[model samples]
Target: MRGEGMIKVTLVRGLAGKPEPHIQAVKSLGLKRVGQSRLLPDTPVVWGNIKKAFYLLKVEQV
Candidate 1:
């Protein structure tokens, strides 16, 4: 995320009527639907956000 490039963050689960915060977290991660994915920089805040929404998302470095 720093020395190299972006990492892949993907939404691997459904968000059926999830809480506002969880929905916001997914939105903040730039994910809208299942299988939705994005490439983001790797950082504590970014990773923290990802972790916060781990119930709805999965992250991997690529």
Candidate 2:
């Protein structure tokens, strides 16, 4: 199991045809293309962004 302080977010879906804000959220998470991944801090702000773009991403504890 991974610790609580970090998360791994991967872009599993494409951003084309998505809403502007959703695209922004994905970019803000540092994912620019499908299969891209980022290790980010586990905070409410990040969580909110993830939730907003949840359909385009896969998230796991890191």
Candidate 3:
């Protein structure tokens, strides 16, 4: 079963030439490459990072 406060974040685009902060945000979510995904807590901090790199990610509620 999935936790109510969890989310799924997937790296859908390459990071090449992207802004440093955006890259950092993706890295902070523990994503290293395209097609990679991480199960993360749904919190303000995680949402902040997701907001920063939304264009590069695919997010879903878990």
Candidate 4:
């Protein structure tokens, strides 16, 4: 899980006043604060969550 198929998802923006779903998506990614990041598998379900909160995240391949 630490190889080519991993992606880094960072909380680049504050979640203040964001919609419930978007907040939940970020939380599900294991991020709880600005600047926090998570190394996640690059799969459809994770991608779906990232897409839901794209504006609040910074995604990059690792």
RMSD of each: 2.0, 2.3, 2.9, 2.9
Candidate lDDT values, in order: 0.80, 0.91, 0.93, 0.93
Worst 10 residues of 2 by lDDT: 1-10
lDDT of 4 at 3: 35
Kindly report which residue stretches of model 3 are placed more than 4 angstroms away from their true locations once superposed. Answer: 1-4
After superposition, the stretches of candidate 2 with alpha carbons farther than 4 Å from their true spots are: 1-3
TM-score of every prediction relative to native: 0.81, 0.91, 0.92, 0.92
lDDT of 3 by residue, 1-62 (tens): 34358999999999999999999999999999899999899888889999999999999997
How well is each residue in 1-62 modelled by candidate 2, as lDDT tens digits? 33368999999999999999999999999899899999999888888899999999999886
Alpha carbon RMSD to native, model 3: 2.9
Q: What value of lDDT does candidate 2 attain over all alpha carbons?
A: 0.91
In angstroms, the error of model 4 at 24 is 0.4
After superposing candidate 1 on the true structure, give the runs of residues whose Cα lies further than 4 Å from its correct spot: 1-4
The alpha-carbon root-mean-square deviation between model 2 and the true structure, to one decimal in Å, is 2.3
lDDT of 1 by residue, 3-49 (tens): 46678999998888778777877888888888988998776767777
Show pairs that collide, candidate 2.
none
How do these models rank on TM-score, best leading? 3, 4, 2, 1
Better of 1 and 2 by TM-score: 2
